[model samples]
Target chain A: MTQTLGITVDNISVTYSNSRLALYNASCYVQPGSITALVGPNGGGKSTLFKSIMGFLEPNQGQVDISGLPIHKAQKKQLVAYVPQADEVDWNFPVSVWDVVMMGRYGYMNLFRIPSSKDRRLVKESLTRVDMMDFKDRQIGELSGGQKKRAFLARALAQEAKIMLLDEPFTGVDVKTEKAIIDLLLQLKDSGHTILISTHDLASISTFCDRVILLNQTILASGKTEAVFTEENLAMTFGGIPTIRNEERGTRNKEEKISTIGFD
Target chain B: MILDWITEPLQYGFMVKALWVSAFVGIVCAVLSCYITLKGWSLMGDAVSHAVVPGVVVAYALGIPFAVGAFLFGFGATVAIGYVKENTRLKEDAVIGVVFTGFFAFGLVLSTKIPSNIDLFHILFGNVLGISQEDIIQTLIAGFITLLVILLRRKDLLLFCFDPNHAKAIGLNTKFMYYTLLLVLALTIVTALQTAGIILVVAMLVTPGATAYLLSDRFERMLAISVGTSLLSSILGVYSSYYLDAPTGACIVVLLTLLFIAAMIFAPKYGLLRRSHSTIESN
Candidate 1:
């Protein structure tokens, strides 16, 4: 069951030390027990926003709170889980799928403490939920792109995090994998888990996402998917929508070039 | 016959000490090298090892323990590289190259200024056979401490090396992990000083883990393989040195290099002759 809590981001702004302004007075509240899709064009500050919420990159102004608690306080209680951009990770790291999943439990235990049976059971269950139980013994590097994404989801699932943030989870995933992930997110949301996913797959956004936050160097609009994901907003989000409205069809795989910059 | 072959090297006390010091050096280096290779910090290892030369030489002149000097320079080099990398527009590799070279040059110049009795060559090229009891004790203690820390924080370090973003997301101190590794690297270099010396210690820190990486996809297997290769190379290096009448450190490094070549040809996935994948991850 999910005990998802709302995330409150005040008028936070982030400017890197190099004077690069990544986010400008971005503010939004992620409603509890709902799935929110963070949609943005390339270099539109989606990942930066995610990092800010995860307490990875601090905001120069304002603060982020989880259910009225500071981000670090919530994180110390293991209240948040994050799945980074798949490309940001080194897949060739010498770890088994099982080992990777076990890393989720690192937050629950103290340093040098071995994983207990409870942790082991959770890892197995999480892998089974992601349809990666059979691949538990396999190396993470040996997995296909879809399998790799599933493994990451499994790791996040094992965190038992009330608030989950996924960045570009469906970038290179297969249709089957994407469908499975959407189903999982829906199911998690139903259980009251707060899920934030950064993605470009607009087709799925209309289907599963309860809320959509359109970002372009800032939060463009955030509300019900149908309410916020209109033609005007899409145009503004991706610089006139490129004569298209996000064409990530059933054709899945990284090699299948997405209709990028708003349309193919 | 097997007994005699094994017992022959056990005859001399110097050989015994050589083998003993190399064993500790091999295992510790192998263990720490896994993290080093995973994080792509081979150059850091090189930088720290070379930077410690002046520290060791200075410690000798100042009547301090060489480890204090080595550790200071090693840690200093790490901070300098980090500072240069952050403060300037230069890339990490460029910063590493510039900072490490400067420290090494400083070390070389300082070596000339020190009394010749300090024997800087021994620091550059190890004299494992001439290792005093004190050196042996220091290597063992330092290796033990460093290896202990690595083992204790294995998963945290592993996660940090693989995905620092996720590590920080999970509330683990990413900076602490980064510097802890540097701390371990410095300790390992000092432990390896009497056996591999400054120049060869980098080889010990990189070759073992890289070889193991070629052999396995799982981290546990990689650890076993790395430790096995390192210990095997140590024994063979010392044994061959006795027979070939060559230097122990050179022989160990040569043996390690030969093993790496063998792995390059025979490694199931990444080997030159056996490359099965079109584009493999370069560990």
Candidate 2:
């Protein structure tokens, strides 16, 4: 089993270059070998938190440590992987699915980035895992939204990182793709991978994720999903009243709540 | 007759030097252009190439090598654009426009004020046929380094251009990659100045990659096609200039534009004609 690494963000504050305080003393701890859903409204510093944890930007206040190591050391050890949002990349870029997936092995390769047989095997295996091997040679722009998401997921999987951060993985994907992604996340959890995902899919959070972090610039509420995913907490996180739906209330009510809550 | 057409240009020493230097510049520009087009930095290329004018003029005034002044100004333009865009609310395109044109105008003003032998017409349009031996040496060395850097860092650069966030997550220093790309862009613009000049160099940096983009769906293939298109156009452009009694730089850019037009209409998958035909077939 892979040794999953926990993420510890210690009261980090991130201010943008324009002097906008995006995240303010926000802190969250994601346990090892668990799935955490980071739920928040737009402009709520979910991205800021992710950036801080990934060391993409230095936190103005505190530190981010992965397991026992600093963020940069964890990164150097390839212990973390990030699947960016669909809008973060230019799909019209001239790389095929195979080429994008092969990038996962670049850190392991030498300066020229020639993929060894092992790297190729890992790429093929990850693509097959995501059921995207059939579209390996196709350009990224030709893929459906779901397939693009899967291709990026396959890239993260190929990285063999113990800690995975997915920024809004469910947005703009079809239901089938969403289901596949959930299943893959579950499997990753079972294999002892620590996963943190920021998403607006509130109902599904209780379904698959073990823990939930409701955030608005700072950590509002965080604990087991059943405990932290309350109506009041949702209201605070989304800055609006949210009607909680029991599992027995059916997906229709849950979906209605998702729409009415305005987190989407 | 065909043999004469091919051999006629080779007989002249200047034409031979022009052919060699232009071809070398074409390869480097084409390679970087793949990244430039895909990264949507076409305007940035235009900005840097134009911004190098003041640098060249200063080099002439101070009796320094043109490459040094050109590189400093090209690099300074990019830095200024970045700084202004970061500090202000203006969009990147606006920043680029403001900075590059200012530098270019400053160069023109300086040229008029300084009593140097620098010809503004030649600097703007290029004088590839009359390139000095020292300029040829500078261009070749600079181009070689730029080509080597692009080749060695191709994968990282591709990732950086495609999805910087993903590149960052994978422990890549995206900032370093960003500056490395800028450095190469500056170097490439400096080298291309000899063959294409300040104004036409952006065409050398853009058209080939764009044409290849329309023709191929793969990055590697895009690169190959860009190189092939650029090299063919360079060789043909030099020969056509010989026959037409035209500027070598203008001929090269015209050829590149023509090839781009041909690809836009005739490329297999993404061509306008192909799409129209497909729609007709479906209808």
Clashing pairs in 2: none
Q: Pick the candidate with the highest TM-score.
A: 1
lDDT of 2 at A129: 99
Model 2, docking class: medium
lDDT of 2 by residue, A1-264 (tens): 233489888999988877899998787789999999999989999988988899888888999889778887788788999998888778888889998898888878887888999999999999999999999999999999899999999999899999999999999998888999999999999999999999998868888999999889899989999999988788777766445434434566667766655854
- The TM-score of predicted model 2 comes to 0.91
Could you tell me which residue pairs clash in candidate 1?
none
lDDT string for model 1 (A1-264, tens) is 233488988898998877889999899999998999999898889989988898888798988988678887787777888887877878888888998889888888878848999999999999999989999998887889889999989988998988899999998899998999999998998888999999988878999999999888888899999999998999888977754523543344555555342454
Worst-scoring 10-residue span by lDDT in model 1 chain B = B274-283
- The reply for model 2, stretches above 4 Å from the true place, is A1-4, A15-21, A58-60, A241-264, B279-283
lDDT of 1 by residue, B1-283 (tens): 9788788989899989899789879999999999999999999999999888788878888987788888899999999999988788888989989888888898889888888466777898899988988778878888999988998898888888888877766677889999999999999999999898888999999999999998889888999999999999999899888889998899999988898899988998788866645445442
